[model samples]
Target: MKQINTLLESNYQSHPAFNFGPNSWAVSTERLAAFNEVYAAAQQLSPTLDADSRASIRQDLEHALNDIFTAFEAQSTDVYEARFLFELKNACVRLMGEELAWYAGQPRSRFVNLTNKRTRQDTVRLQRDRHFFGRLPEAAAAELRNLAESALGPCRANAAVGRLRREDLSVNSGRTVHALRNVLNREFKSLGVLDAVSAYTGRKTRVTGLALELSVPQATWWKNAIAGLERPPRTLYAHVDETIACPKSIVYLSDVTEQNGPTSCYPGAYEAMQLNPLQEIIGRIVGTVGSQADSPLKEYYAKQYHQSVNSENFRRHFMRLPKCLRFNSHIGWDVLPGSELENELAASEIKMTGPAGTFIAFDGARLLHRGGLMQEGERVALQVIFSDSTFTERAVNKLKRML
Candidate 1:
């Protein structure tokens, strides 16, 4: 615990923008005023303004954003910090209230069984200490990055079908696609992802559901500040990839940088959840806590939703279910943000960032994680899921005799 605290404190300075528990980066009044200027300018950017004048304002806004960070290094601090801190505290207090209210509404029995004992400590131990990080040999990393980039051209072309915040790809060209597949498969084995899953489940495992995801720059927050001219961007809430019942997953960062957005996760939190009965309830609501029958793909990838080529128009390919049923199908944040549980989980958060070729192998079904918000540059990655070969048979044996 002392070591973790030390790391968090050192990182707080290195990552001024990062919200590291109560040790947030200090901001000064001068910096706050600069941000105010930018916000005011952004509000006034009208269609009536000449293109050159509008461009100038845009530059001013960019400069102001930089100034805000610069001021953080300066020693002076005052009411600007106090006011902002108050607002931050107030928001959390309100969220805590909401969490309490939610708990009150639940059945009393839900809280009665709470205990002091830890549950699944071993499972939690496996995920603690940032167990998901490693680097590939330079040559191997370079080859994979180049192959992933080759598919980007085709990926962008398909975006017109409708681009999502996360790009999914299907390079139709046989040669390029084949090469990409070969590299990914080779790396998957080299990285010991298959072996790890096999050990976890006590059966041989195979990789499936390989995907390439790309994130590009966009002013997604524009609609949030403006009225109804356009809708706010869709938020990609945190989730686990358990739909395919994969015991584990591996993500390869083909291209990355500090500004390109990194993946964020809550280490040890998955195991912490084992102690909470409410977690099981939340998982059921989010479609992760159920039995095999609850899963659409009994054998995994039973329908197009489970296995489909990536494209802008991919949603159109899924078999339509009733609107009500769709709610249960979404694998999104298991718990509501700003809730009590969310606050408890935040302390364990770790943002994974690296150059191209860094990969994270994890028990995806057990982890609570989310994609990072891209600030500048693009982020590209490949994801692969693995399941034990005997998973289907084991699940079948667990089911009651139909007769």
Candidate 2:
């Protein structure tokens, strides 16, 4: 908080006409006044903005925008910081969008269940921290600064808010959350983590990461620090085929303990899903010792058939590449440079295991993962949301309501 005050104070000093509009150029006075209003508004909108980063962005925008205004007074409408701030703001908006979806996806009445919402919401939130947080591209800065217009909604005020305060949206079903996803995805692509998740999961998508990603940081301080994100992460949400559109999904990370279980994958099984047949299977290793189906058939199967009849369903598994892929963990935060970054990807897909805090980035389409049932203690995981569609109010209603 002190930092933002200090930066704003310093920025004011840079603008000679900030306080004493007593008689400087019209542009200088106008820009300084406008900046001050925004600076003050941010303080009111988010008290936590007093941190060092808020200060940096505030000062950067103040100076950058003012400088652009000065040299191009006639074109004062063109603002530089507008682009950068918008990108950052858009990230926040995405966070809010997923949160809103979490609540809306539930039945209007069931949506009232805070615990249920939180679980699903927490799952998506985890994914945002694992993948999208802290990773920003330089392009957004240019786009917001030059491409954006002054009418752009204030990151803090978010004109959609009108005069309604943050408290106004606190309830289970309120206008506050309903509109958040629209503003977020429409503004920042990356903030929509749920949208990304939906693109990955073909079933009824329940993108956990997108849940409250934008607003959680504001409500909880520890989150922003954990995500290692000062600004918003980029939008990597993608899609597969039409039959299998990634819906919403829960994202999380965990370690291997016999009890905690592990992220399960069917090694090299994607082909079966494509084939969708009745014969093959991937994960299940034919039950040899037990039932009539196996026992009575085992004799006939062994005597009459050299090979066992495997269902295509069993064949549906994630590919395990020779080196890059390993069981349990597909990618590691330490060794992994990025997707296909292990260059020797021609090999089959495998899970790369790691310790706590190890981020596993993967191609969701190719990899099939299941949250294992723990045997010992509770499992710890960092989950994310993946979605393909924009989180509309209608979709949000379907989420919590369906299952």
Candidate 3:
């Protein structure tokens, strides 16, 4: 175990994609030798140990294996690593059997309670609903509305969707908007929204302010046409931004209504998607498929699935997705709508509609959500993505300084 740890420590690099990093070719070469040595040693030592000692050792090994499994779960793996890890995991499963299953079945720890009263209350509601809505302070809201109007007013006149780059802002207005963004960031942090996001993700949080998004009535023409033809358009379906936890916020710069294509989400869907056993199994399958190269079905699988859909074996595993997850298929990740699944969760969907001051914060990765299906009036909003990655944090900080 010490040698194995040393090997992994020397080879591994912290990365969002590959657990062992892109340059560590040694992992593929050395993995089999390490695994075989460990397996042989465990077999030889088992008969000499007492039942209690054996149980303790088994538990420790399971923990170690689960740690490796979880790390691999969060990232992509090459074919060699995937095949070896899969085989090793199966070998451990055979040896540990029901005990391993029982251990892995334990629930994760609950979130720590926040200290501030308002923050605590908001956190509680966010945990329950997987989303929270509030109004920005009137002064701040007014400033934000003014900024959006100045930045996006011309965009509304165009038939196509449009965006105004930060570089395009007048010097004085850019400084004003930048100051306001900083203020809003601090306010969100103080309100405990950032803290709740961190808790949900189990990592430090960073906010990236996106370009103002302007959606006009013309943007929904194709969607309306599809509906008129009795087909469900992609915009009407709910999909996740990621399969993992990623919280985000939206500030309405213009009044948003049901007809204006307000963002919609299903409360409690965040936890449901994460905890579903079927979803977990499918996630593993997708990971395995993604690792392989030159497979006949690779292209088809890649085309059919996105971050939300859990499996690469789409035709087989898709129908087996939990009822809560069926709505994702309708979002066109699977290229077709699952009407039955959509109907099952339709009653619980909440459309975020409010005046220009409305602020909506949600776990976008796990929640079934969709936006920008405007029907009548033009819609303008500012979106902020909250992530737990150091890369995004650094990039945002650099952008801030430049602005």
Candidate 4:
């Protein structure tokens, strides 16, 4: 009990972003008291209970915890409070054990409850952590690996940028390729991947694009490429693809290690970075000034107000700015190196690295992610984007009709 209270206090003190002004503090205090009273009662009743009494007490405790969870869920405007509640609930689950088993069984409405054990676990993880990982069947992975190696052989020889579009494959319409695509599509559909994506974006979604990528040592190439540019490629830094969400799945065709520059992202940032009106305004202004002509004025602005200009909060909000206003032709906004945001993101970073056949899915639009900074060895991967139908499929259909 003492440890729980200490943890609660420590968490509250450390996370300043959760502080939503005076009323929030009051609400937090009330919730804390309520949690303590209920938790203390459970602790007291744990020992010396007969089977019947234990069952009754367990039912009561479950209802109490669910009521608290429901209350926090209802306060959607106070995300910090919800985060706090999530933490406390985790603690309670750990301490109480089987008394709270029912809570663990209840999946969130946003995720499909698949019957397959592996897919079910992955779906639950994706719902909770905004990412999930698995592997393709070994035979399929081997075939894909061979195809990738063959396709990139020329680019590797010249040390050129390594990317192979789906259309560029020599056997793009061959049986092997079709079989592999069918396997992937079937696996993802069985896992309810599209349904999960639609739940996140609040619209229907489908697989929109696919490509093969290779990452090799490019230190000299990158230096020469960025020599006269205002900024390096945005992909070199952590960023989101758009204000609207687009999730991605990547299948590693080669072993990826830290030196191989596997994709990395800040977990939970997808949900945490949601902005209010004031944050959006500040972010847009800072982003606009930073993207202006690379002159003394731009340098001056960066130097004079770099703290706010490069802050993680402002930068995240800036990345969320509407596409029209931002005029960002690239995939996403870059978080400057050594910025406050980078430091925070680094603390929680999850690198997507594993043996060949490893597959991972994550939200690209909302999560701050970056990759392709390889230092040694080569990495071959298949990247696929699954996005809202409104963004890709419908437009394609409209074009077909016009043609």
Candidate lDDT scores, in order, read: 0.44, 0.29, 0.51, 0.51
Ranked by lDDT, the better of candidates 1 and 2 is 1
- Residue 281 of candidate 2: its Cα lDDT? 12
lDDT leaderboard ranking: 3, 4, 1, 2
User: Taking the tens digit of each residue's C-alpha lDDT, what string does model 4 give over 1-403?
Assistant: 0222222223323333222233221124344345445545644554545557656765665565556556645653444334434543444443355323322232234443345666556656666777777776777778777756665665465455433322332233344444545556766676576666555544565565566666677533222121223554333545555333457887788888988868877667545544422222223234333333543234433422123223333333322322211221121233333434435555677788888988778776545576666789877777777755564666899899999
Q: Candidate 2 lDDT, tens digit per residue, 248-289?
A: 222222234433544443333333223211001111212221
- TM-score of model 4 (CA atoms): 0.49
Candidate 1: stretches off by over 4 Å? 1-131, 158-162, 165-178, 219-236, 275-342, 389-403
In model 4, the Cα lDDT at residue 252 comes to 84
**lDDT tens digits, residue span 1-403, model 3:** 0221222222212211113113321222233333334444555575456667667766655565465454553443445445434543564454344323323222222433367776666766766777788777767777777755665644554444333232232122365456656766776776677766666554566565555676666543224212112445243546555223347888787789988879888665444434322223233333333334654445544632233232323323323222322223234223223333344345557888988868888776556677777678777777777755555667999999999
**Considering TM-score, which of the candidate structures 1 and 4 is the better prediction for this target?**
4
**Winner of 1 and 3 under TM-score:** 3
Model 2 C-alpha lDDT versus the unseen true structure: 0.29
On residues 1-403, what C-alpha lDDT tens digit does candidate 1 reach at each position?
1232223223323322222223234455555556454444444443346656655655554465455434433422443333322332333233323332322221222211113122123223333532456566778777866866767876665554555434343433356546756776676556654444444433455654566666655524111221221332232344544332354443555566657767766666545433222122223232221113543222232322321211112122111211111221122222233334445445566767777777666666466566645677767676666544454665787784542
**What is the RMSD, in Å, between candidate 3 and the native fold over all Cα?**
14.5
